[model samples]
Target: MNSFAKVITTLIGSFTLLIWVGKLDPAPYPLTYPSNFGNRISIPQNNPTTQAGVYLGRNLFYEPLLSANNKISCGSCHEQKRAFTDGKVFSSGVDGTLTSRNSMALVNLLWARRFFWDGRATGLEAQAAFPLSDPHEMGQALTVSAAKLRQSPKYPILFQKAFGDTAITVNRITMAISQFERTLISADSPYDRYLKNTYKPSPIELEGMRLFNTMPQPRKKIRGADCAHCHGGAKTYLELFHNNGLDEISTDKGIAAITGMDSDHGRFKIPTLRNIALTAPYMHDGRFNSLQQVLDHYSEHLKQKHLSPFLKGSSNKIGGTSLQLSAHEKKAVIAFLNMLTDTTFIHNPEFSNPNHP
Candidate 1:
């Protein structure tokens, strides 16, 4: 063959060899969003989504070896059935120590700009690393975790498949788990279908939705529940944190711990209303047991000091901020909140524990 022909042939031969040895670039994982979700998926360029990477993440999420005692995993607190929440007021660690705050559900994490109730971690990967080292949580060092996963016969292979190498690092582990979590989009709720005109809300549910979206304005004669202000928008939910007037005196000091500002005291991430019915014992500390209690707090028991501006005309304790919802209105709002539950995401086989499955 001529010189140019030989060069082309050599390139082809190398490419074929790489493919044969399973070193070729793998295809990306198919991540689909519902029509109502819109264009809101923000994945980091470094940790791009791939089938192998997401699969590795799924395995690591359920791996107990990441814990100090080899008994706790990410799935230990974020169960699949209860919308990724542990269904407890406070999630317990491997040593039976309780977390300070309620375990936030892990749905629709791709849309979240911050993680955790207090908005401590800026991204999902950073959020994943905290529990591993938290004394009350997993209580394992990153170095120890890397060593334990390296010692595992299955993890190295999974790591190689995900990142094209057998080296297991904390960054890689977190990236994989974050990839898996980004796929946990929950948009197929009854309310989502209603928005698409595929499902119609019941009369009470319709009333609740109306109340939720509208803010009460005595000047303009507009009676509203005013919930959509904080939990509103076209996408999954708002990423902002708010002090919902849960108490007159803040106990945990919430986001203030991170910002060290009294203005930020009691401010917590406004969790997505989607699957709100399943994530019971609501609020940062899981102070309310039922949705009714939550509504009652807003309608009749809300404190005035440090209340979010969104609740200016909706909180019961504040003169101008009170929503003043009647018994019927409160029940209707509860019905609408229930419509946000998405059943498909929880039962998805892809999100199930790989070893258990």
Candidate 2:
């Protein structure tokens, strides 16, 4: 090639690179702090998340085209209401086939060391692929999904803007969706304001908080239950997987299914209590109906065999055996749980499905 043509090509390429960097700059938002749940608002070093990428991802997340039948989307199962968890005991899949377990809420997952009750997927990028191609979920293989996206006139344009080119790959799809999902943080609960000391909790709520943070004891009356061992801390959250005696013999041996270890049987990931009021039908199976019921399950139950050794039955509080409150203490604990509900995060426009607009 002539020197003149080479010079022209180099100049054009340099100009294009400069333009790309300018377009990739992120937009601004309010100050965000690392929550107890352990996720950061900023993008990772290698991925270098972009606003355009997150927006494109938000659309794909709600789009039905990812499915072979083009009938179901991720939003179908992880709806914004019910705290991003399907209220159904088990989410219905693409072909109307049923899932094995209830859908878990998408809370502060940045801090989580693992994902899913079975702990199969290790990364959020990896997690998106599971439901997309699962025979029961999105029901489309990555190759099939790529074909659908490539054929879509709009998706090609979206993909080009989010990525460098219009070519769609499974990695880009997963990474973008993970970027959007990572922004699903919740922190403006009543409890947050109380902790910040901007507002004071009610008398009953204060009493409940007192009981919740106290250590477990077996012989002292007029004492609080040791509820804080799993559910307390600055984040007021724990990435715990507890057997919780959900069943006398659990049909679902949670983490054990992921790892073929006998001791891991029946253990499920401990969920963040942030917005606990909105997330109902508690536990791995969604068996307990209310916070009061959950409290009762922990208190009235006799054995702590598989329960974290730090936890003992509430023996000092009511009947020298368990949290045998006069129904009043039980009621107060429920009230404290209510403080964790974050309404702003639930209805925030940013987290809503972008395609809905």
Candidate 3:
């Protein structure tokens, strides 16, 4: 061939490569959260959030094909209207098998380093594998699920758009799901609006907010609900685990099951109260059916034996002494808890099932 012909061929090959690269390159996803939520998010360097990846993850989140029976999806247990909690005492899995614990609300997960009630999974990516493989949950093998996605007409193209290839792996699946979950930020509740001076709280709600933040000083006769210790800050909960005085003996063994340390017994992850009003049947075992019941437990029913130090207070009088809140005080506290509900989050179309109208 002549030198001019070879030059033309090289230019044609270069053009084809550019087209291929353009087709595979994913657009960066913009994550928006309240400025009060702080600058840190738990996104991993390997799996940065992208528009194509989040879209793929959202579809996979609602895809029933991930299960053995091809019926239950992650969204089945984590419904959007209920702040991603199914409002069940125990979420039913494939074939009507009950999960060992209640379904946790999937909100503002970008700030969480640990997942689950007992903190079994270290990160969101690792956490996604638990339910997919748990016998009582989705109950499908990761390899089988990957094969199913590979065979699907739509998933291969999605994988290509998200990860620059058509190959589907368990790691990629979890990464995509994690990317979508990180976008589930909820920071526009009444409480948040109150913080921003955009919404005026009622007199009782204002009192409730004040009471919720004040720490109890029994010795000093300072009366307060003392809720801010565990459920405080803009996120409404600390990223640590605690016993919370839930059980005197701790039959389930909570975080101890993972850490194997006696000191960690009865400890569970402190969940965010951002949408606490919507996430009913609170606690690891779903023991309390109402916010009132939860407050009653804290005020009058905290078992002393394995109570967390934060709940113990400064006094030495059996550690788990009641806060002795009056009927009016409890009502005020419940009102404050209700202010955490964000209606905008529950109805956000971006987080809804892509297949639904």
Candidate 4:
């Protein structure tokens, strides 16, 4: 290659590298998962549990210093009251720009294999960086975040205790925060009680549970609607990402967006039913405003060229063997779902922001 060509390539590479590492100069660039109870959380081995690390991490989670403007923290959107979700169709970013998808709840994130509606992030450690740099989200770059945290009076001691005097780094920060988040646990729901045999279920709830577990096929003896197939077993829920046929053609194209797999289009991770009543506006887009609407969606909205074939009826009905239940039956199912709500989890003081307290 000619010397001029080599020099041009070197300059371009340097510029790209600079852009990647560049912080906000207005200064210049930027800032910055899940817990137990259900199955969505998976605590990494590198950052194991410790009182000091968790304490520091929790402080960071609620601290607005992670963002460039010092106005937003992780808790700003993932409010504990709304089951760790913002209750909006899409999450608002740092500069008032909105993201394309709803902010996912941080419940039981330890069991989730992927993060986001599209499953874009492969790990909790890597996932922390996506929102911080998004101009719409935290509006700060990673390099900027390192410098800011390093200069912070509060974070250095945290870094030392958490990592034995490791430098303030993006990797260390993410790990620490993730360790703290993984401590958010909620396994005391009514469903959990039922599993533990500590509490008795109501009559209607019993029937609904039976129906949910072993309801018959709608038309013929093809098959019954098995809630356990996806949402199954003792946990009362599974953490699989599925299209579930929420839409015939989803523009968001959930898992497909990340993996570039055509079949995974419009698929999203299955949310646990724990506290289902409280976390309203269901689905990836928060389209269902009510639990009744969610039930109605399952009952009436399942359609061909849209829903998964697994849910289709023996007669190839639009919705999987339409439950076509009467209002009373619907009420029964709703009642059963309500049993999953745990007042203790909602009111838990440990999960709340210590700064606010």
Output the number of the TM-score-best candidate.
Answer: 3
Which 10 successive residues of model 2 have the least lDDT summed? 22-31
Strongest candidate by lDDT: 3
Give one digit per residue, the lDDT tens place, for model 2 in 39-144: 4333545454567777777888888999878988888878777668877767777888988777888866555556787767777887889999999888899878
lDDT per residue as tens, model 3, 57-87: 9999999999999999999999999999999
TM-score of each: 0.91, 0.85, 0.92, 0.82
- Give RMSD to native, each candidate: 5.7, 6.1, 5.4, 14.2
CA shift at 96, candidate 4, in angstroms? 0.5
Ten residues in sequence with the least summed lDDT for candidate 3: 313-322
How high is the CA lDDT of each candidate model? 0.85, 0.74, 0.88, 0.70
A best-first ranking of the candidates according to their lDDT comes to: 3, 1, 2, 4
Show the lowest summed lDDT stretch of 10 residues, model 4: 25-34
Native-to-model Cα distance after best TM-score fit, residue 236 in candidate 2, in Å: 2.6
Better of 3 and 4 by TM-score: 3
Candidate 4 lDDT over 120-164, as tens digits, reads 787777788888778889888878888888888777766766666
Question: Residue 186 in candidate 4 has what lDDT?
Answer: 59
**Cα error of candidate 4 at position 199, Å:** 1.2
- Whole-model alpha-carbon lDDT for candidate 2: 0.74
lDDT of 1 at 114: 87
lDDT of 1 by residue, 1-357 (tens): 999999999999999876654442366988786655667667888999888889889998998999988999999989999899888899888778899999898888888878888888888889999998898999998889999999888887778778888899989989999989888888788887888889989999999998888878766677778888878864538888898888888988888988899888889999988788998889989999999999888877667788876675553323555567889999999999989888887898999999997
